[model samples]
Target: MIEICKKYDCVGCGACISACNKRAIFMHPDSLGFLYPVIDQKRCVDCGLCVKSCFNNHKPTFIEPLKTCVGHVLKVEEQVTSTSGGLASVFMREIINNEGVVYGCSGENAHEVKHIRIENIDDVNKLKGSKYVQSFMGLTCNSVVQDLKANRTVLFIGTPCQVAGLKAYLKGKEYDNLFMVDFVCHGVPSQQILNDAIDAKVADNGNLRLVNRVKEGGKESKYTLRLLKEGKIAYDQAYPSMGYITGFLSGLYYRENCYQCQFARRERVSDITLGDFWDRHDDVKGLNNKKDGLSMIMVNTENGKKLMSMCKDSCELVEWDYEDFIKRNGQLKQPIRRHPKRDQFEELYCSKGFQSAIKESLRGDLNRIRKIILFNLIDSTLSTIPIIKIIYKQLKLIK
Candidate 1:
């Protein structure tokens, strides 16, 4: 019997499953709904392909970023609607116009997020924004390999572990046409938690048209759930009403591997890294106003520079200090510390469900509601009154 990695070390990227030719490997979910690869001893030939392709077994070397900058889509409407500066949308359009296939995460509703391929430019909208849940990567890596073998241009955008896993699955084959992108991930929660939250909150039996993270004036929100019911806003509340968002922001529960993620550091595994520039707009050189969205981009290779040059006209890019940039984005330096009560949260979740688990786990933090209100007040004040924003920044109160 061949073991890929320990249960806590597996990211469930499915590379081993795709690499196996004899169909000996299959993914089975644990009680917490996180997937892991299982090998069938009867069909195993021990070719070692599975181990060779597993990212956990052969850790890919990390590359320092060649260039770092802040950027955003030039179109106001696009920037306003995007999770950050709409750079991902620009990349998607560029790939589609060149007649390349783009693989990204999309779901019919909140509960079904998965990686899918899209070639048409119009369908790019499906891939926009972030899905808070861990995306299912079922056989998509094989699809990517097939496209690459046909001499077709391919752009894959996913979490860092997924990107590393796909490259591992390719067995050192080089593809000049392949462009890989990953983001500064805020560790993903399981599908079971998301499903339970939707079930508890969405009273109307109507289909969930969509689920989105709400932002205030393009600024990130810590506690908002914007679920659409039949194409209209249904739930727009914060914790303790939104238990999932509460747990997510609290860092109470995540996949076991996320706390020990090897890819969460300054050295990156992808050609390019994209994430929200959390610093104030004025702090960013190219962004003059403080209201709209902005994105932090780290170009890791020549291919990343090529991609950015191709997208030059679609967005504004300005140089930023790499050392200063990482200060705001801690994931660039280290993985999130494992919550002390993480195991307790999981145990409660298995028996009592999402709401009860979150409530009990966060019960000690009585100041949560107060802090949220204060943060919102500061956020609104900073957006509207410039003088107060300066004072708050000087006092080291808000960032």
Candidate 2:
């Protein structure tokens, strides 16, 4: 009997499934639609390859970034359309122009999110924005290995844990042509929740498409989730339709493993890390302070430096202090603190649907609501009082 890592530790990167030569490992969604590996008992030869490849069992080495900076695409047309800074798009384009392949998560439809590969610049648009749900990595790790073996330059962009899983799946074989990039992950809610939200909005069964984290007036709308049915707006992230994003930001419905993520530290597993530069407007010199998106780039390896060099012509890169960069992004310091109502939220979700469950779970918490309101009030007021801004932020009032 070969035991893979515990279910609570699995990030569902599918590396274990790809590492199995006997095809014994299969990924099945749990009650909440989060995937976990399930081995077929009869097909098992006790080979332990699956266990060996499990990122939980074999942790990848983490290295400090060689360079860190705040950057964004110089082209206004491109920056306005991207979720953050448009740096990822620039990197993808550079890779494609260099005759390399790029793999990234794409929302195939309103209901499905999965890893896909692109070799052309036109296809890079599909991989541009943020897909707030977990991406299904269906044998994509194996594809990465194959591409590397064929002497093709490959760029894989995913969550930090996914990068570790791909490295573990290779059994420590180093590939110079393989470049990995990961974001400062805020943890992922199960795709099922997102699908359910879309279904609730588009009850008429019309053709549905999802455009997540839309930009408004050339500025990224961080709280927006848009749905298109028959090419018209069906559900916008307004009052009643805001349940999914609320739950996501509340940290109430992420995968169980996300609460215990080992990759949430400052040290990174990927060659490069990209994320929204949340502190760009916070007294940082030489930073673009516009409402348009900006990215915090961390070059962790020589390959990462090479990739950044390729994008230098198209981006405005400003070096930044790492401590200030990590201050606003909570995911870089530690895993999200699990919400107190997490279990209750899941229970209500199983009984009622996603929207109703969100309402119920978040209801009857006047004290919490009051605190949030008061925190926002003080934080907002600090802008006018400039002197209190530092004091308010240092208090750490509502973490």
Candidate 3:
């Protein structure tokens, strides 16, 4: 049996509840509008299968010498929309073209996360980009395993933990038909935070009629929440939605184990690891200025290499030397965690006892702004210094 706190670290990925052979763990929603795990100890044998299955406990072993880029690269020009790069769409398109099924996260009727199966090219839009929250994986792994058993090609995309969990659950099973892709994840945010932000937005407005079309305008445009009173844009405003970015950057959006993630090192379990290629070819003028978007595609296996090669004509592929890749991503040494002062702020929010605590924390608002300016200046200056470059490389252990 497993025990979990209702309000604390449980984002309820359901790995534990799903892993239990005795069916001891079940799902329950707390006050925060998110599901959490509830354990029935009487049926539990204490076999620890749940613990073993938890991605929190079991870290995947990464295999290296994975193929770099040997595929054709073309700049993808299509109407396809995605989180950053449209790589996932491209991958899905190829799979569908070949009559294969693509498995990925989709929002269900209740807006809950659920695994979806797409076989049509037009439906590929459903699975593109990062969802940035816990997805209800459902029994998709079981379905994928069944497909692989029948010699059908399956493309799976998800967070590292979800991928790891699938592989672990199907241990000793080998299938050539499976192609796994994991995001070079920062972390996922809690559903509560998302609900809170949405509620706050609704309250700011009069009615719950407006829906923000995040990707409608452009990538950089501030997200607008539009009020729809009878199928018309009643009121709209452009502002940063705290729910989306805050949970993403703070790692509170991730599973608790993700902070001490064992799979976050050089070697990764997935065939290909994809993420935002933040910096590439700084010495070359036009390459690094891609303010629009680009994918940092890392092929980690022969299968990944083959897929990339097959899709070469669809997208622009650039070969990044290992030294440059490390240098670009190395500055993010510590994964984002709860800020040190966040606990105190959370305490004040909970207790509602001391108004002074909030006042004290907010007293230096101007000073905080000044510090941010200075910090950005120092960061920009250091990034250019030759000596600092040497130190940065050394710190990342880049050869």
* Highest TM-score model number: 1
**What's the ranking of the predictions by TM-score, best on top?**
1, 2, 3
lDDT (0-100) at residue 224 of candidate 2? 53
Show where candidate 1 strays beyond 4 Å. 204-210, 216-223, 239-242, 288-290, 372-399
Ranking by lDDT: 2, 1, 3
Tens digits of per-residue lDDT, candidate 1, 1-399, equal 788778788888888888888989888878878888899999999999888888778769799999999888888777776778889999999988998999999845677778899999888878887777788898888899999999889999999999999999998777889999999986888877777877888787355644455456555533455677666777665654436776776677889889988988999999899988865335655464325677889999898888999999999888988987788888898888887789888899899988888788877654776687678667765755778767766866443
lDDT per residue (tens digit) for residues 57-89 in model 2: 976799888899988898877888788888888
Question: Residue pairs in steric clash, candidate 1?
Answer: none
- lDDT per residue for candidate 3 within 208-227, as digits (tens), equals 34233334443421234344
Q: Itemize residue pairs with steric clashes in candidate 3.
A: 73-317, 74-315, 74-316, 75-316, 188-253, 188-254, 189-253
Model 2 clash tally, residue pairs: 0
TM-score of each: 0.91, 0.90, 0.71
Give candidate 2's error at residue 116 in angstroms: 0.6
> RMSD of each candidate?
2.9, 3.4, 6.3
